[model samples]
Target: MKNKILIWGGSLLAFLLVVIVVLFIFRSRVLQYTIERVITKVENKYPADLNIGNAEFVDWNSVVLNDISFVPHGLDTLFTTDSVYATVSFRSIFKGRIVFKRLEVSDGYLTARKNGDVNNFDFLFKKSETAQPVDTTKGRNYGTLLNRVIETAFDNVPDQVDFKNLNASYKSPNRMIDVRMPFLRIDDGYVESQVSILADSIQNNLRVRGTIDPGDYNINASLYAFDEKGIRLPYVKKKFEGEVAFDTLHLSLTNKRYRNEKLTVRGRAMVNNLILNHAKLNDEDILVKESAIDYVVTLGQNLFEVDSATEVRVNSAKANIYAAYQNKPSKIYDLGVKTEWMPANDFFGSLPAGLFENLDGIKASGELKYKMKFHVNMDSLDYLVFNSDLDASKDFKIQQWGNTNLQKINGSFVHTVYEYGKPVRTFTVGPSNAFYAPINQISRHLRNAILTAEDAGYYSHKGFHEEAFRQAIIKNLEEGEFARGGSTISMQLVKNVFLSRKKTVARKVEEAIIVWMIENLDLVSKNRMFEVYLNIIEWGPDVYGAKDASRFYFGKEPSELNLNEAIFLTSIIPSPKRYRSSFDSYGNLRSHKGYYYRLIGGIMRRRGLITQEEFENLYPNVKLYGRARDLIVTAPDAAEEDTTEFELETIDLLDF
Candidate 1:
C-alpha cells in the first residue's frame, strides 16, 4: 500500500510541474493580448493608434513596454518612446482602481505643429470652442460632468511620473521652438521640469519646479531662467537685445473666486548681468549689473492691481524705484524713482546713444542727484502730474556751440526747439537774420499780437505752459501726430537757437534741458531772447525777421507795422513754411485770415496792445505789392547750406 501511494504522489507532482511551465512560456502573449484589448477600448473614445513592440510584467506590481509609438487616428505620429515602465498598486486594482506607484518614460520624441488656431495634437480628443462663458444656472451640470471624469480618470492616473532624454519640437508659421529635457519628474501635486531651449539666435536654460493643486486652482512655483546670449525685446517696435540672468524667482498664485472672483500673485525676482543694446540708438550699451524686485499682482475681469518695489544698479549707479498701478474704477499709474549722487556722465551715458550726438565734445563737470514722481490716469489728464528735481554741482561745457555752456541747471519746462546746426541749418545760415530787430525797435502791436497768439502765458510761467502743454499732449494722443505745441516764448527761442528739427522724444528731452539751462542761468534777458526769436523767425519763402518780414509783406519798417499787418504776421508763426497757403491766387488773404484777424485783434485789445477802435478797424486787407529782395544773413561761425530760392525754411511749432 505504501509503494502504491508513493507512485501516485509522483504522478501528481509531475502534472503540476508541467502546468506551471506552460503558463510561464505563454506569459508574454497574455500580456500582449491584455494590453491590446485595453488600447482598443481607449480608442473608442480618444481615437488614437498605439504601436507597441513588446510588453511584459515584472513580478505582479510592475509592467514594462518597449518601442511604443502613439499616432492620432487620422494624423501622423505624435510621439515615440524607447521604453515605459509602470509600477501599480495591487490593493488599488482589487478596488477597481489602477493606481501607479511610479511610471517612467525614456528616450522619447514629440513633434507638435500649429496652423492658425488649430494644432496637430488636437486630433487626440473631441474638439470644442476655446473660450466659452460659464452659466451659473448650469453649474451643477459641470459638477456632474467633473465627477464622471474623475471616476474614469481615477483608474488610469499615476501617482508619480518621470521622463528622461525627451526632445520636443513645436513649429508655427511665424516661429519655431525646440526643447531638450534631460529629466522631468512629477509626484502627486508636485512637478519639476528642466529644459535647454534654442530658438532663432537665442539660447537659454530653464528649470521650473513647483506644486500645482488643480482641485483648488492654486500654484506655487520657483523659476530659474538664464541665458549666456541675450534675448531680443521689441517693446515699442524698437529692437533691444539684452543678456538676462535670474538667480531666483519665486511665484505663488491663489484664486479667490468665492470672495472676489480675483486671482492674486506674489513673487520675488532677482536678476544679474543685464546689458542691453539698440541698433537704432547707435549700438550703445545700457548695463544693469544687478536688480532685485518684490512684486504683487491682483487681477479681475476688468480691473487689475500691481505693486512693485525694485532696486536697480545701472551703469554703476544705484536707484530705488517704487511703482503702483490700479485699474478698478479708474486706471492709474504712479511711479516714484530716486537716485543718489552720481557723476553726470554716468547719467548721460545711460541714455540712448546718439541722443546727444550734437554735443559730443561737451563734458559735464559735477555730481547729479535726481528725484522724480509720475502719475497718470486713463480717463482725463486733470489728475496727471509729473514732478522732478535734478541738481548738478558744476557747469557743462560744449565746444561746438562756440560759447554755449550750462551752469546751475534745474529741471523745468515742457518743450524746447533747437537747430543742431549740422542737419538743419535754417536758423544758422539762411535769411533768418537778414533783418534783425531789437525789442524796442519792434512795434508793441506785433509783440502783443505774438504773445497773444502763440503764448498767452509766456511772461507768467517760467518756461512751461502747463495747461496748454497738457492740452497739446491730449490732442496729440487723440490725433496720433505732432499736431499741436503750446510752446512758450523762451522755449521757442531756445529751440530756434540750440536744437535740431527732428520730431523725436530724445530731441525733445535735449531741447528741454537746454531751455532749462537758458532760463536758470539768465544767459539772455527775456527781452533779448524775444528779439533774437523775432529775427530768426521765418516769415515767407525768402522773408525772415521782423525787418524783412515787414518789408516783404507791406514795404514798411518793423516799427511802422500796422495793427492789421502785425496781426497777419503773428497768425502765420504756427506754420511759417506753409504760410503762403493763407493767400489766394490773387495775393489777397483768404477767408481764414478774417477769423485770425478777429481772434488776434480781440486778444490784442484785451492786453492793451491795441485800442477798441484799432481792433475794429483791423481787417485782412493787406496787399502784397512786391517781393522782398534776395538777402542772406549767414553767421561767420556757421557753415553754408546750398538751398533753392523758393525752399521755405521749415519752422514748426516747438513740440515737446
Candidate 2:
C-alpha cells in the first residue's frame, strides 16, 4: 500500500509540472485568443468600439502592449493610450489569473463632452436588460457590504504605479475644463501628483501628496494650490452659477472597523481660505479662513449615523452635530446641532451668507449659544419634532448694524420696493410721502382689519409665532414643497424694509433674523412697525400704503375707511396684484368671501377693535373708485382671475 501511494503521488507531480510548462510556453497564443473573445463579447454588449495593436507576455511576470483605444459609437474617443506595460503576480498567472503588481502608462488621453443635456459618458452606467430594479423600501446591510467592497477595491490597487504625460478634458455648453498631469507616481503606497488645470477662463496649478495603506485601510492626503490662489472648483460655476474655491484641503481616514454588524469610520476633513460667491448669496465674495469637521461615522443594518462626538469648526466658531438616517421599519431622520457659547461676533460671522444677510458684518458684545433638534418619520409626518432657538446671554447687545439698520424704521427714511431685481417704487416711510400715513392717521378699522387678516398676534409676539412656524414646517414637509409661508407682521415689515422681494429660503431666514433683532433690541416700537407695514406694503398693481388703498377702493382718506371697505382692502392684501379677481364678471365681490369676512370680523369684535353692531352689519361689499375701478373686468373669465387658493391660504395662516 505504501509503494502504490508513492508511485501515484510521483505521477501526479510530474503531470502538474508538464501542465505548467505547456501553459507558460503557449501563454501568448492563449492571451491572443482570450482578447479576441473578450472584444467580441464587449462589442456585442455595448455601443462601444475597441481597438488594439497587440498584447503579449514579454517575460515571466511582465506584459507589454501597444496602441489601445475605446470610442463610443457616433461620439469621441473616451480613452486612448499609446503604450501600456504591467508586471503581474507570478502565482496569479499560474493560477489562471492576472493581478497587476506594477503598472506604467505613457501618453494617454481621456475626455468627456456634454452639449445641453446630452453627454458622451452616460452609457457607462446604463442598466442592462438583465439588471434588477433597486428596491429601496427594503432595509439593506450596508455595513457588511461596504466593508467588503472597500477591502476588495484597495486590494486591487497596484503597489507601484506611474503615469507620464496624461491629458483629461471635459467640455460642456456652459464651460470647459482641461487637466494635464505631467507625472503621477505611487511607490509602496506613497503617492505624488503634479497637475495643471484650466477651467474655462481660470488657470491653476496644484500638487497632491498622500500615503495610502490598503492593508490597514488608512489614507492621508493634502491638496495644495500654487500661489495660494486656491483651487477653483470646476463645473460648479456653470452648474450652480457660483464659484467655490479652496486654498488647501486636507483629508484623513484614520481608522475603520467592522464589528457586531456595524462599521465605524473616523476621519478629518478640512479646508482653508475657502471662497464662495453667487449673485443670490452676496455681491461680494464670502470668505472663510478655515473650516474643519472631525467626524465619526457609523453604519449598521439600515442605519447611518454621524456620532454626536463629531466636532465642527468654522473660523472661530465651534459646534457639534449628530445626525442619523434609518430606512428600516420606517424611513426616519434625526438631526441635532449644539453650539458652544461663542463670542457674539464669532457667531454672527459664522452664519452662512445669504441665509443670514441681516447679521453679516454686525458687531456685537457678550456670548451666544444655539441649539436645534429635528426628527421626522416619513410614515407619520404630523408627529415630526422641531425645536430651534438662540439663547443669547443677558450681556448680549448689538454694537453695530450690518447690511441694513433696524433703527432706520424708527424715523422717516426713503424706502424703495424692488420687483424682479429692479427698483419699482421709492417712497418715504414717514409723513414726507403723501401716501405714507401715521398710526393714528390710519383708520382704526383698516388697521384692525389688516392685523386680523395677516397676523392677529402682532401685538403680543416679540418677533416670531412658534405655532405658525411649526405648522408651516409641517405642511411644507408633508407636501414636499415650499407651499406655505410663516411670515409674521414683524417679519413682513422687516422684509420690506431690509431685504429683497425675491422669495427664497435664504431670504426668509434673513427676514426672520432682522425681525428678531428689531424686536429684541427694541429698535422700533410695535406701533411704528405696524405703521410702517401699512405704509410700504404693495396694495395693487401700482398702488402702495393705506392712504392709497383707502382712496383706490372707496375714494376716501385713511381715516374714512369703513368696516366693509376695510375688510375688502385687507382681503386683497394677500394678493393685491390680482385684486380684480375678488369680483366676478358683474364686478361684485364673490359670495364665498363673506364667510371669511365674518370669521375675521368676529375676532376683531371680540378684541374690542369693532363694536357688536359693526360686526353684525359687516358685508364683503366695496366699490372701486380710483384707478383700481378700471382694473375690474366686466366680462372676466373665472379661471383667468381665480384667487381661491391664494385666499384660502392667507385666511388659514391668520394668527387669529
Candidate 3:
C-alpha cells in the first residue's frame, strides 16, 4: 500500500507541473481572450459602443489599457482616456479575492448633455420603456449594481488611486458648467481633492478632504466651496462627522425606510453673505450679511437631541437653542430658546427682501430679549402647553402706518362667524361702532374663560405658539389631515385686522411678521391687542365683535357676561357660522356642545376665573334664545358696496 501511494503522488505532481508550464507559455493568449470577453459583455449589456487600441500585461502583476474611448449608441463619445492601468497582488488571489494595490488614469475627458428632462448619457444605463425583450443573463443587474461593483472591485479596498488631468463638462437647458481636476489622490481610506469649477455666471473653487472607514462604519469629511472673490456659499465651508446606515434601502424619498441608529456630529458651520432670490423684498436678491451656527447634534434610535445650538451673529440678533425629540411609544419634543438683546429692526432687516416691504416706515428702536420653554406631543398638537416671554428694554413706537402697513387698517369688519360656506367678511365695515371694552373693563371671568378655551398662553407668549403648532403638525401626520388650528390670539388678531381673509402660506407668514412688529416693536399693549381682537372678530353670523356678540347672545354688555355665558361665547369662535349646529331646533344647546361648554367652564373655574361654587352651580343647559321676545339680532347684516364682494370659502375649521 505504501508503494502504491508514492507512485500515485508522483504522477499527480508531474501532471500539475506540466499543467503549470502550459498555462505559463499561453498566458498572453489567455489574457487577450479574457479582455475580449469583458469588452463583448459590456457592449452587449449597455446602449453604447466601446473602442480599445491595445491591452497589455506590463509586468507579472499589472495590466494596462491604451487609447480607450466610449460613446453612447447614438451620441458623441462620453469619455476618453489616453491610458488606464491597475496593479494587483497575485498572492491574495490564493486567499480568496484579488486585491488592487494601485490604480491610475491619465488625461481623461468626460462630457454630459441634457435637453429638457432627457439626457444624452441616460440611455446608456436607463432602459427604454419600449425596449426589446432582454435575456436575464445578458442584462445588467441594476438592483444590486452598487453591491456587485463594490464586491467585485472593492472586495479588498485598494491602497491608493490616482487620477491626473481630468476635465468634465456638463450642459443643461438652464446652465453649463466645466470642472477641472488637476490631480486626485486616495490613499489608505483617505481622500484629498482640489477642483476648479466654472459656470455661466459664477466661478468656484472647491477643496474636499475626507476619511472613510467602512469596517468601523464611520466617516469624517470637510468641504470648502468659495467663489473667485473668496466668498463662501451656504453649502460650502462645512465639516460633518457621523455614522449612517439604512434599512430596507431605496433611493426614492417616499419609499425609503430608516432604522434607528446613533449618529453624533460636532461641527461649526458658516455662510458668508448668503443671497436669496425674491421679488417681494425688492426686484433684487436679498443679501444676508452673515449666517452661521455652531452645534452638537446626537440622534439615537428613536430620539434626536441638540445639546448646544448657538447662532453666530455679527450684525444681527444672537439666538441660542437646545432641543430634543423622542419617539418611544409616541413622539415628543422639548426645546428651549433664548435670544439676547439686539436691534429689532436689524433682525427684520435680515429677513427676505420685500417680505416686510418697509423697514424704515415703522420708526422703531429697541434692544429685544426673548426666552421660551416649549414641550409638546407630536400625536395631538392641539393639546400642547408651553411658557414663553418676550420683552424689550424700552418700548418702541410705530409713528406711521404705510399704505401697505398694518395701522392703515380701518374699516367696519364683518364676519359671518358661522356656516362654512357663508361670507365670513366684508370690507365695507360701516359705522365702526362696536363698543371697545378695555381688558380691565371686561369681566375677568370672560377673559379667563376665553383664555382657557382659545389659547392658554396668550398673555405669556409672543404672536406664535410653538408647542401648539408643533403638536398640530404631529396630529396632522397621524390623521392625514390638518385637524388643528394652532393659532394664538395675537396671530388671529393679525389675521383679522391687518391681513386679508385668504388662508395661504403667504398670509400666515405676513400675519406672523405683523404680530412680531406689534409685539417686538411694542406697537400695542397685549391688553389692547386682545381688546381689538374681541371687537373685530366675528362671534356669530353677522356678529362682529364681543359687545355685539354679548348683546346678541346674552342680551347684556360685555363687562356683565357671567361664567357660563362667557364659556359658551368662546366655544363658538372656532365655528361661529356653524354655531347654530350646536343648538337644536328648539334652540337648546346640543348634548355634545354642552359637554364642551362644561369642560371649558371647569377649566375656567380651575384657573380661578370662577369660584368652585360657581362652577358647581354653572348649568350647561343655557339656551341660545331665552324666549321669542328675548331674541336679539346677533349678526346684523352689513351694507356692501359695488366693489365689496362677499364669498365664503371655509375660513376656520379648527376644533377647540
Whose TM-score is greatest here?
2
Candidate 1, lDDT over the whole model: 0.63
The stretch of ten residues in a row with the least summed lDDT in candidate 1 is 642-651
320-359: candidate 3 lDDT, tens digit per residue: 8789887766778888888877675665545544444444
lDDT for residue 374 in candidate 3, whole number 0-100:
76
TM-score of 2: 0.74
Give TM-scores for every candidate, taking all chains together and pairing residue i with residue i: 0.61, 0.74, 0.49
In order, the Cα lDDT scores of the candidates are 0.63, 0.81, 0.62
97-156 per-residue lDDT for model 2 (tens digits): 466678898998989998876787777655466876645556666876677667665765
Name the better of 2 and 3 by TM-score.
2
User: Which regions in candidate 2 have their CA more than 4 angstroms from the true location?
Assistant: 1-149, 157-162, 166-180, 196-205, 226-243, 259-262, 277-286, 299-304, 327-329, 351-358, 605-612, 633-656
List ranges where model 1 is wrong by over 4 Å.
1-80, 84-106, 110-112, 120-165, 173-175, 180-229, 233-259, 268-293, 308-404, 407-436, 477-482, 494-498, 513-525, 540-560, 625-656
